[model samples]
Target: MKRPERMARLARAQRALAEVAKAESIAANARYEDSARQADEILDALNATNVLHGFAVKAMADTLRRNGRTTERLRRVADERASQYVRQERTAEVLEERATQASSEARRKEERQRIEILVSSPRRR
Candidate 1:
């Protein structure tokens, strides 16, 4: 080929290569920007999830604490009631014992009076 023709063709090739390089660079930058946006979205979602988990854990702990306190109070009440019942039962037993002793004493007195009356009136034959 002639020198001028060859030179013109080389220039055209160089221009084409530069255009392709510019297009590639633009595409690479767009891809990088999209990837960065997705990463930011993922980070935001993770942060929100962590916050929700923390709140849930705190609420559950509070509920457990309240339940524990309630159970302790109920146990204390039951123990006090049991003690009162035992005291009442002991008092009833003591009263019953006293009543039995009094009844036995009265029966013995009546038997002695009957024997005296029968001995004194022994001339009815």
Candidate 2:
């Protein structure tokens, strides 16, 4: 209900979002790496001289080209996701810091109020 509490909750949500973004970025990068490995295998297949079927080699070459494009696209997606994750993480950090400051300020205010009350009250002998 308080400002610090609300800010803390928001910071937690942002951290969760950042974690999801980080996972997505890692997955994208893995997919790109796998695609690249497949393209390399296709190249190796094309290099084999004992291939009986010419059409198969042509098909493999075409597939390799397509895979190259896909890999590039995946790389771009991974980079974008990584950047998004960084931004989200930074936002979360800032929110957390602000929440901590607000909480400290609230405590100080309460302490001051308590001190004022104690000082103004008369002690009974």
Candidate 3:
């Protein structure tokens, strides 16, 4: 009877060890799954950030290109307008010089006519 009791106690100890091992395995599996989920979330966030940065950089490049084209066009227009102003000033100077020459010629003709009229008229004694 003493030997049978000892055998029964050993069987109960074996069952307790098996239950503890199974519980530990279940907890370890749960921890691994939680870590996997966190890793996947981090990867997704990194991908999204990379895509946004790419778009922002592209937009900035396009804006700079457009500004460069606009600046070049404005410079061309300024050059053309400056040339036009110079042409107009030259034309005004030519017209003013011609008017001065015509006035001088008219004065000389009037003075010659007055001298001939005085010489042709009879003198009063």
Candidate 4:
């Protein structure tokens, strides 16, 4: 395939990849939100309780601590995925622009070649 066409195909592939990345980022964000919400609920439960056995209190505190850590990890993962999506999106846009430029350049070159041929050819008269 021609350079311009190949570039265009590559750009399209990049766009697809970017879309996938965006979806993944969104999913990650949702997971992070869910985890955070669960952690908050756990915290609220811990605070609302006035009477609890020693073992139950320890278990709740341990669960809350674990949930907090999981929430933080999920948040970081979501942030990383979002950053990756942005990078992929920018790469797709740049590839599309380059393809357009290549196509334009090819057209201009062909036009110049045609003009040169016309100017050089002898008249049939």
The model with the greatest lDDT is 4
**Which pairs clash inside model 1?**
none
Q: Which stretches of candidate 3 lie over 4 Å from their true place?
A: 1-56
Q: Per-prediction TM-score, please?
A: 0.50, 0.94, 0.50, 0.90
Q: Find the 10 residues in a row with the least total lDDT in model 2.
A: 49-58
With candidate 2 superimposed using the best TM-score fit, by how many Å does residue 75's alpha carbon deviate from the native? 0.5
Error of 2 at 25 (Å): 0.9
Tens digit per residue, CA lDDT, model 3, 1-125 = 44334444544554455455555555555555554555455444545665476656655556555655654555555555555545555555554555556556667787999999989999979
Residue by residue across 2-25, what tens digits does model 1's lDDT show?
A: 444454455555555555555555
- State the weakest 10-residue window (summed lDDT) of model 4: 46-55
Candidate 3 vs. true structure, TM-score: 0.50
TM-score of 2: 0.94
Q: Tell me the spans in candidate 2 whose CA falls farther than 4 Å from its real position.
A: none
Instruction: Report the Cα lDDT for residue 63, model 2.
Output: 91
Candidate 4 residue 36 C-alpha distance from true site, Å: 0.4
- Model 1, stretches more than 4 Å misplaced? 1-55
Order the candidates by lDDT, highest first: 4, 2, 1, 3
Q: Residue 89 of candidate 3: its Cα lDDT? A: 50
